[model samples]
Target: MITGAQLRDAYISASNLIGNEKQKVDELNIFPVPDGDTGTNMSMTIASAAREVSRFEDGGIGQCASIAASALLRGARGNSGVILSLLFRGFAKGLKDVTEAGGQQLADALAIGVEAAYGAVMKPTEGTILTVARVAAEEGKSAAVKGASAVEVWEAMCEGAHRALAATPELLPVLKKAGVVDAGGKGLTLILEGMLSVFQKGIVIPSENVEEQQPEVSVKRAVAEWEGEITFTYCTEFIVGRGDQKAEEDAKNLRAYLESIGDCVVVVDDDEIIKVHVHTDGPGNALQEGLKYGQLLTVKIENMREQKRRAEEEAAAAKPEKQRLERAEPENDVGFVAVSAGEGINGLFRDLGCDQIVSGGQTMNPSTEDILEAVQAVPAKTVYVLPNNKNIIMAAEQSVELADRKVVVVPTRTIPQGLSAMLSFDPDRPQEENLLDMVRAAEHVSTGQVTFAARDSEYDGHRIKEGEIIALNNGKLTFSEKTPVKAVTKLAKTMIKKDSSFVTIIYGEGITDEEAEEARSVIASKAGDNVEVTMVNGGQPIYYFILSVE
Candidate 1:
């Protein structure tokens, strides 16, 4: 029998195990694009649930599973994360109201999870995580029917998962060509193996071993002549228990009060709690005002000036810096949210009518909650989302269910596609009409990308070397060159069709205006005088240039 506590322990062990092996799984990615985040996304998704589960001191097996399922859904990041969430959701459904589950019940739960996962995907692919899970569940069911113990059932499931994972290369030609099994399947097998370890060895893997290492902080004070005083000294955050108070009315009052005292105030209230974030000089006053609603569950106050000084010092020490984006209050009928990286690309999206821009693409994929937050910030009844990257589209779609506004995710696979889609938008037309027009516009445009190869590999008979500029024609690797200009020019020549008249080259962060112009001239020379070439400062990372031909 598996009790609630043991089940929780098993999941915790699984998260830690996956975290430890995440990089190994990441390296298995064969897709020529640099977005190798399946392992990280799945690990983070499960870790979110583990953190939530750890908070519950007392709960039945069903209650624990439900808590995990809810957290997984909300925290899901990429396609793998969403699929993992659906699997857990189905598992939770099977264990409803059960204090404990035995072998047969556990086996049935696994099957249910597999079914839910397969059902969720629009077109389920074989040899991926889905196949591995399905095979494991089927074997578990068989074992249970033969009157096996819970441990025996789990053992059978793990064996089946391993076998399925090994056979993935046979099912997917890409895997065979890459000389690797499915990354998602490998990740899933590691998770199941971790769970089996908990049941077999009575050991729970600790997260501390695989925890991310924090950079060393060295506070560098500025030269005495240019010191500035902080306007809002204190950063205040607290959560109020929603005891007998009406959440909506009290939340409104709380927001008003916080706004009066603070510069940056954000109050989010639910039936159970009222969470407050404010930047004010007087932290004591903010705490006093918060107490009027309910008892304060957690309180945190920090000196902003000190924090800022430390951050500056860290920047001076050569540490990477992260920019924080502020959320805007909702206020329009139709709004747009786009995902992209680089200041130039972000500015283009804003200028082209995107209300909110999420900073992510390629190597960095934003979570569903990140998109949902951006959606909520847009004060529109209907909001349109442009995911800009193919890998990010599924994550963006997951935000629709959680968003307060009607979210329509336009499947724009490239930044140029997103820009083209935005150009086709008509405010006067109905949403469905606009959707069709935007989708059509995106489809009509051909996209090409130039980026340095992260590793040396041969794909589709092309031998690519590390540090070489690689050209991708609509997500497929076409050619590799020693120079960006050669790659972009070659890519343009291939992308420009018989009727293609316009060519747009968006240069990234590494290229200067002169270099970009030279690249543009090279492209123009290759494309002939008939093609009208335009160059823009995209300033995006990873890719040296993004090309669009229509």
Candidate 2:
């Protein structure tokens, strides 16, 4: 049986392991685009649970799991994080009211989590975290039925996860071509391994690796005062979802109007919306100006002086509470937070047992402020943040010092690796063991992606034209073709060399099911007999297909 204390230790260990292996996870990103980040997302997802576990006085295993599940749900940022939270939620329900659970109970809990994860996703697919988790849980259940101990059953489960992960390439041609396992599947294995380590050994203090940081700003003070006195007390911002009006025209008009009223006027527009940032005395006038173009989706006005005064007062009053809180006896657990962008990807992480999600990606990077809000929202003593996108990693790390919760940032740079790292997590093991396991799994992946060129560009000695299909290996352009299927096959072949066993292709927006099947057939022919191939609907924007190898 595993006690609540053991479960707590396992969570802490998992977070640490994710943090250590984060870089390896980042490297597995399929795109060179600044947004490829999965390991970071998984790490952050689990951190929410870790932080929640840290908040309670020694509680039963069930209580800790419940708290972790709840915290993960609200703190979830991206697709992976949200899914991860769902998995834990099922686990919590399965372990309900129990101070501890035997191997049989744990197996049941794993099954429950798997079911919940599947339920959360709109369309479940093979060759991903869902596959790895379902297979592993079945193995665990079988082990338990054979009268294995909790440790023994979990070990079997990990082995099963490894096997399933290795098989992902066969199921998905992209994975086979990339010569890497499913990134999300690999992450799930790491989570299980981390938990196993806690059960087998004691908690180990994490080694310090000084992470670089942006210049720390006391944003928590809620205000900045200048000696020159406040010319404008409020910072106002609004986003208008584009209607029939052209963004450029709207931006031009908004800019001209803001220039007349505000000194610091910033207006930016994207395909979907226009964002206006300005320092103004009258926020109403700024908002009124926005109404000319379209519907306002979001609006914010911050009173600099009032915010500062309140922050200062709150900090002063909370000093004693903070001191007492700091002196409280330490617990053995930690939690994580992640950011993701899609439903399928979200479900993949949840099935692996992530604690939270921060919804964002490519076209939009969650501000440091958004990440900070998630960190504070998680009810844990210590939380880890994963900014899966390389661009967001710095922003995620920036939230650590600002957070009252002890925060660790694992820089996972891609969705695939982020999912792989979470699969590596385990709640039954010591911290060091789990951390090492997660890191190892993340390091073992190679990722590839297939997309179309936004414009013609001649670089890296490859002649490229607008509308050409392109394939990338860890961010570098490898091939360009006329057809999506041919481009996908070429990319897969480039990635799946000797020793390849599995391949997975996740098709995205605008791709029809018939087209995806055609692409699959081409992949199957090239995959050879030893390899398996499969396809899925990622339903994401931008890229047409994401491939993985193992």
Candidate 3:
């Protein structure tokens, strides 16, 4: 018999197992859209249920499964998350009234979950999580039909899952090309392994990461978010030894003093030590007050303003573009929505008359929903989207279907192409002519990038190593260099032609001012006097420099 308590613990173990190894699953992605977040999405999807189930003390499987299904549906993040939620929803439905499930019941539940997952996807493909789940469920059902125990059914499911995962590449050509199994399949196998460990061995796998500071962190964030304006700049914490009979009086006075200088004050004391946590403008004064009680054992100070700024940046990245774009009814003739990564790059698009700029590029590709939100933010009859990165083009296209107003996606695979398209747009011309001109303008421009290799791999006969400086011409790896500065010059020279009229060097965040000037001088001298050389601070991430030749 399978109990709700065991299932709850099994899922918790699975969540942690996948969360700890998400990066590995992410790396298995061989697709052009290289966000590689399948593991993270699956882990987060299951974690939603795990967190909710942890709160309930009920041992009834029906009640526990219902709560988990509701939580998973609400918390599902991406495509993978949605599929994971669907599978669990089916599991809940199959075990609706069953408190303690037998081998047959468990097997039937697995089959139902697999069926629901397959039905959820519009065009279900093989060699994915669906395949893994389907195979596992079938194996479980087979074992159950043969009069196997619940433990035997689960073991068969795990065994079948591993076999299916290994065969995923054979079913998907892209996986074979990339020499990796499907990321979603791998994620499912890990989850099953974690669950099997608990169901078979009665041992719940512990997470390496401990949430020791979760309570304090929640309190800090709650107070920070509620206060529109931060009154205190620093967050200070200290622990002091309790000296003599006067320690309690000093601790009481310290609390009062902290309350006067800070908004959130927490002073806890025992017979041996006095612990204090406060947000204040002056950390020095806070520490000095703590010293009066006894010798300070531990002292920590953090700038709240900096932390808040970082939090805002992360929120911007997660939600939508950082630019202040207001949603309005379609009133104007036409507007533009450009996707870019850097602050300087976004500013350039804004200056070029883009109504909204979506924050995204390469590895951090924004979702279709994010692109649609940016499109809706524009107050134009027709909105044209320029996805600067190749990975973002598909998402930008997807937004066209959901947008309230007319959305025409001009597939700009690179930043330079997007800029060229922006430059070529003319209000005097008709919409069709303007679109045609933009596409042609993008086609004429050539793009070169200097970036570090993310991982070591043998691609196109080139033995690439991680951390190696690499150059890409148009979209293919041209060469590798020892240094960023050297790679910039090498790639620029390779891209420059005798008839090329303009060379624009867009330097990113990590490139120093001196390095930019050095590259500009070398390219200017090397490309010769006829071709004009110019440099601008792009402030982008990933690539050190983006060379544009026209």
Identify the candidate with maximal TM-score.
1
Backbone clashes for every candidate come to 2, 107, 0
Tens digits of per-residue lDDT for model 1, 31-79: 6557837899888888878767754545688888899888888778778
Residue-by-residue lDDT tens digits, candidate 2, 269-291: 98778988876788999999898
Q: What do the candidate models score in CA lDDT, each in turn?
A: 0.83, 0.70, 0.80
257 Cα displacement, candidate 1 (Å) = 58
**Model 2 TM-score, all chains together:** 0.44
The Cα error of candidate 1 at residue 87, in Å, is: 1.3
| Cα RMSDs, all models | 16.2, 24.4, 13.4
List candidate 1 segments past 4 Å from native. 208-331
lDDT of 3 by residue, 68-93 (tens): 88777655545666677777778888
Candidate 2 or 3, higher lDDT? 3
Worst 10 residues of 3 by lDDT: 211-220
Cα TM-score per model: 0.78, 0.44, 0.57
Candidate 3: lDDT of 81?
Answer: 65
Which of candidates 1 and 3 is the stronger one according to lDDT? Answer: 1
